[model samples]
Target: METSKETSSNLVKRYQRYLKLEKGHPENTLDAYLRDLDKLLNYFQGEGKSPLEAELEDIEHFAATVRDLGIGARSLARILSGVRQFYRYLVLDGYIKNDPTELLESPKQSQHLPEVLSTAEVDQIQQAIDLSKWEGHRNKAIIEVLFSCGLRVSELTQLKLSHLYIDEQFVRVMGKGSKERLVPISPRALDELGYWFIDRNQMKIKEGEEDYVFLNRRGAHLTRTMILIMLKQYAKEAGIEKTISPHTLRHSFATALLEGGANLRAIQAMLGHESIATTEIYTHIDTTTLRKEILEHHPRNIRYREEHKL
Candidate 1:
């Protein structure tokens, strides 16, 4: 029997397991979601409410209390989402006949555009590399691949030599939830990879790690934190002040292609996005580019120019 005191804790553990094994969420995401759930459960505990005993009014009261406590709209939205997902799991398991969160809604998140580097800025960072170092070529290849392919940091770290199809002009990328897609390789990226491979082939690779694409000086695979630290170092050296990461490169790749008139669906496929909506965010990144094209090519602008004879 599930007691009121233990119900929240027990259900949260079950939800945690479900998120990990069944939903396949990454560790960081799982931890964040679990933390959100804990906050909700603890709030209910103070109100003497069990998971089953809680009503929509009770949840709303908690939301109001958190709002009064000064939780920002975006964070409160995520907390509500966590509660919503937890209740969803309960409904699925027959623990609840109706979800109390069915009528709940997340607050509208502020549209914070992702940071993107221009082609020149990207070149500036690449040129800052110390060519005398053995890792110089390797780091250059990493940057080229990141900006060219729009891969997430985890995908970049997991990249393997076997996944490269350079001769065919494509590289296989395993994205979230192990979903795989073939992203085309740019000529510049391929050239950098070639130069790096020359040094990579000579390294005393670790046993059973021979198939990895980008390894450290010790011939071991690079971690996500290492990639982040490396990007920060290069950004500082290049004299560019914008905070950046592998994801910035990824965003830059998509934004550049969009600015170059690439099809949204084509970008979506290359980025391995399951939803077109997720890929649509790139369209909102730079209205200035779109405005330029409009003024340069719009029929009204062309007619006005011809009429003015200037």
Candidate 2:
């Protein structure tokens, strides 16, 4: 018979493989889940219990200790989610008849809506660029690619020259978890990218760094922080007040599509969202635009207006 320690180790190893192969979780996410599970294992060991034998009270005690450790609401919620999945895995494998985490409730997270840029604001920022400087062309291309494709900052930074298919109007992107998807590129963005390439070819690129799509003046690929700083500078120059980031452009891309009557599932596909529910937040973000469309086209609204005409 296996000792409790051996059983626990084997279970954790099995769970890690499940997350990697079946769930396809990214490295950082998988690491976090494993750490959370380790916390649970430590708590169980203190009580002379194995995870398969943990009771509701044991889970509750773990939660209390986690809280006492001053974990933030968001982090605490993620940790609990990991722990719950662990219990669920045990039940599915027949190691436990019931999940101790079945009754667990995650803490409520505050709803913070993503900020989006208006079309005019976007135009103002891009138009404010000084194209005389060669770096200006590169910066313009960065902004266009970000807003046009709704790319994550990291994705934009790591984009390679080989990934772009200008003739096909598509750019291949390796998204979270190394999941590759081809995102459509707008003509305006493509035009700007072509212009940047004209200037890019003149630069003396560094060894082993020739394949990056966007590079700094020194020929190294742009960093995530540099993108954020550039956005902040442009936002100031455009006189837009609300705080913005590269992600603001991504949110704006989705919001504009939603307002333009694009299908939600199509938007989900373009944005590379794994779940439609994850993409549904845009519906909530554009309620005012949605209301306008309903009032303009709904049959009841049309009838009411027609009858009230004097």
Candidate 3:
């Protein structure tokens, strides 16, 4: 019998190939699935049982253990989902006769909405960039496209100049799972991109990187970490207090559209959400905005606030 580490490594590689080639999962999803599987493999090793030999009780115990570890409901659910997919693949490829994970239940999902930036805050972040510097145009354009298009950081990094339709005002984005979508560009964003291109053109362009829309001074594509660090620096300079990330801009984009009366389904398509339920969190955000307005300006609430003032 092979050792747990050796057997699990071979199976994990096979599972990865299946997810990437057959299921068309993107790189991030592939990595997540692998991480999820590793957790189970570690548990199985501790119990001196092979993953292929796991029984229903073994799976149940695993789930219970994860819950007891204080993992969040959303993450626990995804872990179970990943494990199920792995077993289903095992059953298909003849490594196992039956999937032991079939009856396992994911935890009930909890809604953890991300913070949304106000339009003024978004502008303040952009304005924090100094245009006199060489990289200023590129950084400003990055912020503009992020808020304007509501793109995932990966999608933004993979953006290409060839996919841009300046005349039609749409940029073709290759989004999650290798899916493609055309997102409209605001004129303000377009002007920023135009400025960026002028800076981009002056560089001694690196081969194979010329087609990529956002490149560093070394003439290579920007990494996701670079984007995060840049946003943090600008946010501090802008004096905005809310915790920010690329997804905060994404949430802001969706919330602004919802408040401006854009259809929910349209926002769903723009955000590339596979489900409308994923996009519906903004409705809660919209409601939160309404409640704030009532608390601040409603006649009854105003009088209560004034009376309660110490």
RMSD of each: 14.6, 15.6, 14.6
Q: Which has the greatest lDDT? A: 3
Least well predicted 10-residue stretch by lDDT in candidate 3: 291-300
Badly placed stretches (over 4 Å) of model 3 are 1-111, 275-310
lDDT of 3 at 283: 39
* Tens digits of per-residue lDDT for model 3, 198-287: 999999778999899999989999876688789988999999887787767887877777776666656676776643456455434443
Candidate 2, residues 1-310, lDDT tens digits: the string is: 3434457888889899988998899999999999999998898788777777776556766876787678877888889999998878777766768787875556656744557897778878988889998799999999988887788877899899999987876788998557787777766677889999999999999888899999998989987768888988988998888778887888787777777666565566667664445655654434334334433432323444677661
lDDT of 3 at 32: 90
Decoy 1 TM-score against native: 0.59
Error of 1 at 292 (Å): 24
- After TM-score superposition, the amount by which residue 245's alpha carbon in candidate 2 deviates from its true location, in angstroms, is 0.5
Distance from true location, Cα of 301 in model 1, Å: 30
Query: In model 2, what is the error at residue 85, expressed in angstroms?
Result: 27
Clashing residue pairs in candidate 3 (N, C-alpha, C atoms within 3 angstroms): none
How high is each candidate's TM-score?
0.59, 0.57, 0.59
